[model samples]
Target: MLTELHIRHFAIVKSLDIEFRNGMTAITGETGAGKSIALDALSLCLGSRADASLVRPGCDKAEITACFAVAKDSPAARWLAEQDLDAEDECVLRRIINKDGRSKAWINGSPVPLAQQKSLAPLLVNIHGQHEHQLLTRDEHQLHLLDQFARHNHLLEATKAHYRQWADTEKQYRQQQQAKADREAQRQLLEYQVGELDEFALAEGEFEQLEADHKRLSNHRSLDEASLFALNALYEGEHNNANGLVQSAGQRLQESVDMDPQLGSINELLKQAMVHIEEAALELRHYQDQMHIDSAELETIEQRMTQALKLAKKHQCSAAELYPLHQQLKSELQTLIATDEASEQLAEQRQTLRQAYREQAKKLFDSRQRAANQLSDKITSAMQQLNMPHGRFEISVDHDNQAPATAKGTDQVQFLVSANPGQPLQPISKVASGGELSRISLAIQVMSATQQTVPTMMFDEVDVGVSGPTAAVVGSMLRELGGQCQIICVTHLPQVAAKAHQQLQVAKHTDGKETQTDVRALNNDERVVELARLLGGDKVTDLTKANAKELLAS
Candidate 1:
């Protein structure tokens, strides 16, 4: 419930402060007399777009503040808490617009974004006007409003979860199908590469061994000639042969060894050298015989080494890495082979999720239909006293099973109306006049408010195009609804304005060169004059005041 509103330098309202109360409190003023300014101020706090042009000509900025008495668990309070804003049992919202077209909004003294303001607005007040009736025409908004009125929040949450599940499942199914399609192209590439690698059949360390063999074979003739020459010089050469020379020296050293013991040790050393020289010559002969060069084998080994190096460079890796690369390709091939294996499983899972989505959607549709019938009947009963004797209102539920399911549901619901006798009921947007729409909107609001948990309801211009008994009925209905929650109605009807438990009059006054609008809570005597002014005009005649008093007395 809005407890108070303060406006400064906003439009024609230089400054205004008004305290509001529970039950219907009407605001009455002449046309262009700043009644809409009060509503505009409220709209600013409720997140409506701000225009710098609304500022008083000489003012630098326009500001509006609205205070609401909120419940601890009220949606508005909850929203404020979620946004990390200050919220207590009472909430104060302030909006300021500067002359440069910049605007700032605050909740409970904490600055907040405009989006947060909009998200929190509905929790503070619900305004039903000529435009708000669009809620009845739009399918999703209608469902949401109806569910709110029915207090089926938990059910709506469940439906939303199911909708999300359906969407997620479809997304996964599409991805899996695309993966299957992509696998075929990948398989062709993997198969060709794997075939090439398998055919090579290269051995580990084989490249190193081949390189060694190629070097040895390339110098085989030179190695053979050097070994043969060394062998002849060591064992078979004339006087310079190492074996013959060392033996001859050992014989001389032994003959001399008898002359001295040191000569005998030197002879032993000479004999050892002769033995080692003979062993070396024998090994050289063996190598000379084994050094047979085969050009064909050398060519084959050289070609193998060249091919390995070329493949390594082409793949930008060493020859040793080719084996691991082969294994990777084989693994990918297996994955491609198994792509169709899981296809059936995906289809089955999709069917199951589809069935679950349908079941949840069906349950939501059934609950809405049941609740819509009750709501339609309740609102029709309330519309009777507003002067449409044979007035009929209905909720037409159209199932869109063939249409794709949306987040709300697979059903479309609209409010239908017939304003006069024998007139076929049509969509509320199509058949209702401004007066009829006002009353219908009020009736629906009354019904919806009764079922809501909100602590306040604010009505702006709800009494437009209504007067006399119709306005009285509207006022009485608002009062009745106010018994359930805080109700505030902005009106110009003297009949309705007179019915307020509290009366606030919006008066514009020009003091010297300054123009200002201020809202005042009228005392009983003042209310008489205000209502008389509403009934008559700028001039409140004595007869008008008498009639106003009489109306109050009744």
Candidate 2:
């Protein structure tokens, strides 16, 4: 329920603040008195598209704020929480339009994008324009409105779920078919690459080990000569060589062992060192004797190393990475083969899902038919009170089992009407004039709104062509609806305005220098005067005042 609305520099409204109530509130004024300005201001905060032109002629910007008292578990509250903008049980939506046409929206004092404001609007308020009856002629909207009124959420949700399953399966099937040729091409590429890598049979660290072997073979003669020189110098040197020096040290230590007991330990250490030096000298000599190079083996090693480097460059990888790359390619090949195996199973799954979609759609079609009948009767009965004495309203559903399923279901729904006797029922859009449509729209909205979860409903100029007893009937209908939710009605009929629990009178005040629009909540006597002006003219007679009082009493 909307608790308060504030408008500043919006259209002709310089500054206006009004508190709203839970039941019906009527807004009325003479022509050019800014009667619709309040509704327009509320709409801005409700996410209607904004323009800078809406700003009061001399003002720099226009701003509107609407505060709603929301239920904890309502959709509006849930949306606010989802957006992280909840403020206890109150939700405030604000919009600002600058002179340069820039607009900003906010929820709970936090800035939000325009799209978010638009999304939350419907959940908070449903505004029906004078021409919204034309929307009833569209199939989907008709179907949707009927569904809302019928409260067939279970069937609708089940159908939607089944439709999603079918759609996903179909999408998958089409993608697989489209990719068949491409997958085949990829398969051939994978096979060729995998075969090449398998034949080469690369291993981890193989590149480094092979390079070491190649270097050793390529310089075999130089290594052999160097080892021999070192062996001869260390083992066969006549003086100052390693083996000779070690022997001399050991003998000296042995000579001193008798004088000092510590010298005996040093003497044994010298003996062990000399033995180790001798063993090293012999090993070097053996190495020199065994050293030899095979040119053919060296050539083979060079060729193998060159081939590995070339393959690495060809695959855009390091020599050591070749093995891992080969493994990855093989894994992908196996997955492709598995996809081939799964294709047959996916076809079967698609068929099963398609059948499920059809069955659910059938159920939805049957439910819609039943809902349409009930909805038509309700609205048709409502139409009679709104001045359409012979008006007949209907919801027509044409179910096509063969029609390709849409997300909504397989039935085409439309509203039909016959405003006069023997007129022959026609599509509502063709049969109803602007006035007739307004009343019919009122009836439909009243019927639909009773079943809606939204807490606020606003009707702009809904009583356009209605007057006399018919206007009272429309007023009564709105009043009845107000029992269930808050209603804000912009009307011209005094009878309609008189029936409201609250009356707001819109008036334009002008001086030679400035002009402004003001809206004030009318008290009991003030309401009677406003109604008298509506019933009479610029000058209200005593009779009109009495009639106004009588209207209010009714």
Candidate 3:
């Protein structure tokens, strides 16, 4: 339920704060007293369009804040939790509209997009505008009303999901059918590329090793000559070679070792140098033995390298990248093959989805048919209480089995009405007068309200064309609705105002320079005066006061 509304510099409201309770509230004032200003401000908090004109003259901005006490398991609470904006059982919606026409919204102190506010508004409050009866003429609106009255949210959601699945599968099937020739061409190209790469069979790291081997083979003669010369200089020379020179030096140092201790250290260094020289000589001899040039191996290595380069150039890659490219082409070929398989299965998939969608749509149609009957009966009964005793209301639920599937199913809902006895039922839009439309709209709203989960319902002059004892009856119906949830009505009828558990009077105040509208809760005595004003005119006579009291008493 809406607990409070705060408005500042909104239109002519200037600044006003109004507290609400868990019952019917009647808001009334003189014609130009701005009784609807509060409702307008509340609408802004509910994510209605905003404009610079909504700001009071000379004010920088307009602000509206609405506070509600939500039930733990209510739709509003669940939505807030889903958005991470829940503040226990309390929800606050705030909107600020600057004079430049830009606006911002917030929920639970966290800034939110205006769309979120719009999405959450219906779960918290249902506002029936003064002109709501105009919407009843549309077929879509009639269908929506019936579905809302049906209260089959899960069924509706399931039908929508099924429809989406069917539509998506059908689109995929059509696209695949159109692209069959193209896919087949692509598959052939991929297969050829993959086959060539597989035949090459390049291994990881093998390219670098092959290049090294090719270089060695190509320079075989130069390498063999260099190794032979090094071997002769180091060991094979026999005279003054490194090995003989170091051995003679060590023998001379050994002969002087007894004469001086320093000679012993020198002799040991000479011995180590001779050992290293011998090891070097042996390694050089072994390298010379291993050096040989084979023309046949060289030709074979050159041929393989040329083939690798040629293939790399053809594929627009280096030899090193040939392996990776081959793997990539194989993957693409596999994907195309899988797509072919999936396309072959699409017909069966689409058939299954189509059947599923039809099943859900049928279920939705059945539920709506049952709900239409119940709603028609209840609204017809309500019309009698609203002073239309001979009126008959019926909801026509026509299911078209041949129609293409839709998210809302294939049922065409139409409201039919007869205003007098022995008259045939006709489309309500074409038959009902303006006053009858107002009463019928009210009846429908009342019946729909009973099925809604929203805790607050506001009616802005929904009783516009109603008067006489019928107005009193309208008031009584609203009061009865208040027993289930909060009801706030912006009205001009004294009977409606008198029926409310609480009343608020909107008054306009003006100085020479400025004008502002103020809304205040009325005391019992104050309510009587306001009702008297509504009953009579600006001049409240004693008889009007008496009549107001009588209305209150009743």
Model 3 segments beyond 4 Å from truth? Answer: 185-333
- Per-residue alpha-carbon lDDT of model 1 for 331-428, expressed as tens digits? 88987777656666667877887777778778888888888899989888878878878888888777766668677778888888888889998888
Number of backbone clashes in candidate 3 = 0
lDDT against the true structure, per candidate, is: 0.80, 0.87, 0.90
Clashing pairs in 1: none
- Arranged by TM-score with the best first, the candidates are 1, 3, 2
lDDT of 2 by residue, 326-406 (tens): 899999999998887787678999999988888888888888888888888989999987878899988889988789888
lDDT winner, 1 or 2: 2
Per-model clash counts, in order, read: 0, 0, 0
lDDT of 3 by residue, 31-87 (tens): 999988888898899999999999999999999999999999998988999999999
Model 1, TM vs. native: 0.80
lDDT of 2 at 194: 90
